[model samples]
Target: MNQLPKESIIKLQSHINKEVVIQFQGGRQVKGTLLSFDNQLNLVLDEVRELPSQRILGLVICRGALINSFAIDGMVEIENPYI
Candidate 1:
């Protein structure tokens, strides 16, 4: 298999440990702390929360295929309260 070029990566990895909002294909959105990601854009997030209802989903792995777009959630700090 051919290796992905460094610049070809989506650049999400740089945001690790930060809060992010992911928009899915069907208008669904999820917000969480970005734990990690891969070349395919698959995301591992902690403290996941669904929008609107504000439901908690804990840790989750979001497939890249279902992701329409994503971004860092505002300028708010998302540090764990308990430390």
Candidate 2:
């Protein structure tokens, strides 16, 4: 894999443990807490939920290639007893 640009690395680091909504092709969207990412922009998320239907997905890894765009999670309160 090619080396990730410094700005991309910094952006990913800042979003670690934060929530984000990743929108992919074909109108699919996934929302979850950002767990980890790589130079490829592949993402691992916890407490994931598929959009529209809002199905609760425990964990998921989204392929960077399939990702079209992503939005930083807004001011929605997340209730997690265990920090």
Candidate 3:
């Protein structure tokens, strides 16, 4: 199994329990609180809701292979490395 990069793990750790938006293959999107994640990129989310339609899905476990992309909800300020 391919291991997650250290930077990616740190970023995910920072987003734990925060709201996130996940886009799955075939163009489905969901919004929820990030509960946990694994090196495979598999995720466990709570209070999930389908995007656009706002249908509630409660808790969900998303397969890493099916995830297209994901972004943390709202603005996140990154420390400027060049500062």
TM-score, cand. 1 vs. native: 0.77
What lDDT tens digits, residue by residue, belong to model 1 across residues 1-83?
A: 99967664467757899999998999998899999888778899999999968999999999998998788855455789897
Better of 2 and 3 by lDDT: 3
Candidate number with greatest TM-score? 1
Cα-based TM-score, every candidate: 0.77, 0.75, 0.76
Candidate 2 lowest-lDDT run of ten? 4-13
Model 3 TM-score is: 0.76
Error of 2 at 59 (Å): 0.6
Model 3 regions more than 4 Å off: 1-10, 74-83
Q: What's the true lDDT of residue 6 in model 2?
A: 60
lDDT (CA) per prediction: 0.86, 0.86, 0.88
Quality of model 2 by C-alpha lDDT: 0.86
Pairs of residues clashing in candidate 3: none
Per-residue alpha-carbon lDDT of candidate 3 for residues 1-83, written as tens digits (9 for 90 to 100):
99965645345888899999998999999999999998888899999999989999999999999998788755466899998
Candidate 1 vs candidate 2, TM-score winner: 1
Q: Write the per-residue lDDT of candidate 2 for residues 14-72, one digit (tens) a residue.
A: 88998899889888988999999988899999999998789999799999989988789
What lDDT score goes with residue 25 in model 1?
Answer: 98
Q: Would you list the clashing residue pairs of candidate 2?
A: none
